[model samples]
Target: MLRGTAAVSVQRLAPEDLGPAAADCVFEALAARPKPVIGVATGSSPSPLYQALAASPRDFGSATWFALDEYVGLPQGHPESYAEVLRREIIEPLGLDPRTVHLPNPHTGDHQAACARYEQQIAEAGGIDLQILGIGRNGHLAFNEPGGALDSCTRLETLTEDTRSANQRFFDSPEDVPTHCLTQGLGTILAARHLLLIAQGAGKAEALRAALKGPVSRDCPASVLQLHSRVTVLADAEAASLL
Candidate 1:
């Protein structure tokens, strides 16, 4: 467990070792539930876990999935969009039904209404059984950037320079990435029954340390995970070095 915080269990392993660690936890969750309502996060950090789940023998045909966030103002079929990324990496490989997957609607004209609707949908599904998260180098979860309201719900938010730069590789150029996104807020994520926060590599060590040891504050959005009752911090040895 991470020291100096609440009961957040931490698993320190090598970068290559994180995949099986996370996959095993996810498998346990799915086996215990009939139709798991799961929240899935995107980005390179969780790729290994996604691949492991795809190769796992579990049948997720009845599972319902929710994406953490999506870029606003991107084209319908943009490859970098969270929707496409989830399809290529998770949905297709895992054989999950596309209709059962949900994401905050970036294309909706009434962004506020869309967020509310998405929240309602989650509630209707009996809330998320397990939420998978990836902490940013800046300590942001999903696209929940720093200095925002901790209780804020899903809504449009401007992207920080750090987040944009980190995500630019998926786009043609740095400027090509969208400047805004629609993300589930800290409050929304906290509603999950269980949270699996994954961080790997030495580059993420500082952020992991802050999130686990620092005070609960919006400065490091991920620090809010400490407030949750059921959170598992899965990190690589290098990422846990600072702790």
Candidate 2:
């Protein structure tokens, strides 16, 4: 049911199997090309994989990482900031040099310029070797909420109520959640040579199905994977039920 114009490798597995498998994939990529540049997503969904990756730090020495998105207007040290999350999960544990990891400045006054500069930095890093993703309840990617254009870029976005609610757990109260964010567009995400998306839990089943089988549309942003040359989707049984 997951139709694609390009050959996408679909690896369906139990959620319990994903963390180790993801580590193996990282190892393989690193073995093939040392100093590989990696694109990372933050959220509870990717925690397991990050834990596994952190367990093997030396294997990650050659890796450079880029975060998928950040909440606009939030300070860098904010507890809910993606930068803080990445530091705890991917940076410190993996012993990755801070200089090698690039993240957009969410608090920049000139957000548009920040985005353009970020894009240029990505290109200068030889492009992303692998991009990691997690699906929103509404099938969004990064912060690209439903209805995001297929060829989007790094820019500001108004967070949907659904997305804000889904992310509220990170804040003390729903009211504390930011209403805006800066996310990499579908086009930016698709530019990676390889894509790996991880989904788990029963709640993700519908979105996973939509991503793999539904029509590629701005309404279901993640569906844009249909156009990517290499995409590997790893999901738990509950998440893959529809597939």
Candidate 3:
């Protein structure tokens, strides 16, 4: 989809085919840099892609990874914490060194300072070469909820009821889900050289449409992708139905 100077490439494929397709994008990013710094998202949508990467013969040992967000108040080793989730799903499977993986510090006493330090780390790593993302049903990118500033930087954000409800399946109950998170802001995400967003299932149809076709606005946080120079959106048949 072309909107003036910004272009978003949209591809629709079967649910099973998304992994390989997304892997191709990852490999391309890896090939472009000697030591690619990838921004990885934690969620069900990106699970297949991680599986594909893990199964491949590619050597991801040299690549550095930064997580997009982490649930505040979750214990360090909590099973559902984004950090541990990434360790189990990506680091372990891909045989990546734990030293090369980075995630926002939700346990910090001063969250504002933690957010700044994270941004500095990314900058020192030469910025992210490729950023993998998954849209929330509410159109949020990462934990950047609606009403957030488009130029917002990495910071703490309170999760909305809708976001909490959507994530309840991962917890024992809705109340167990964290009320806050530390997320890479829209500005930080936009700084990435390339973006690959994957979506699946009918539940994501409307948000995917709004992200790829709706007007660029804070109301639909993902709609901000329309302003980026390079963005690739891969969705399954059901998710692309509204598009």
**Candidate with best TM-score:** 3
lDDT of each: 0.87, 0.84, 0.92
Q: Write model 2 residue lDDT over 61-151, tens digit each, in one string.
A: 7877888888886776997888888888888888878888888877769889988888988999888888988999999999999877899
Looking at model 1, how many pairs of residues clash? 0
Residue 202, candidate 1: C-alpha displacement in angstroms: 1.9
lDDT of 1 by residue, 32-127 (tens): 788888899998778989988888887888789999998999888888888999999998999878999999997878888988898999999989
Model 2 regions lying over 4 Å from their true place: 1-6
Residue lDDT tens for model 3, 64-137: 89999999998889999998999999989999999899998988789999999999999999999999999999
Q: How many residue pairs clash in all the candidates, one count each? A: 0, 0, 0
lDDT of 3: 0.92
The C-alpha stretches of model 1 lying farther than 4 A from their native spots are 1-4
TM-score for model 2?
A: 0.95
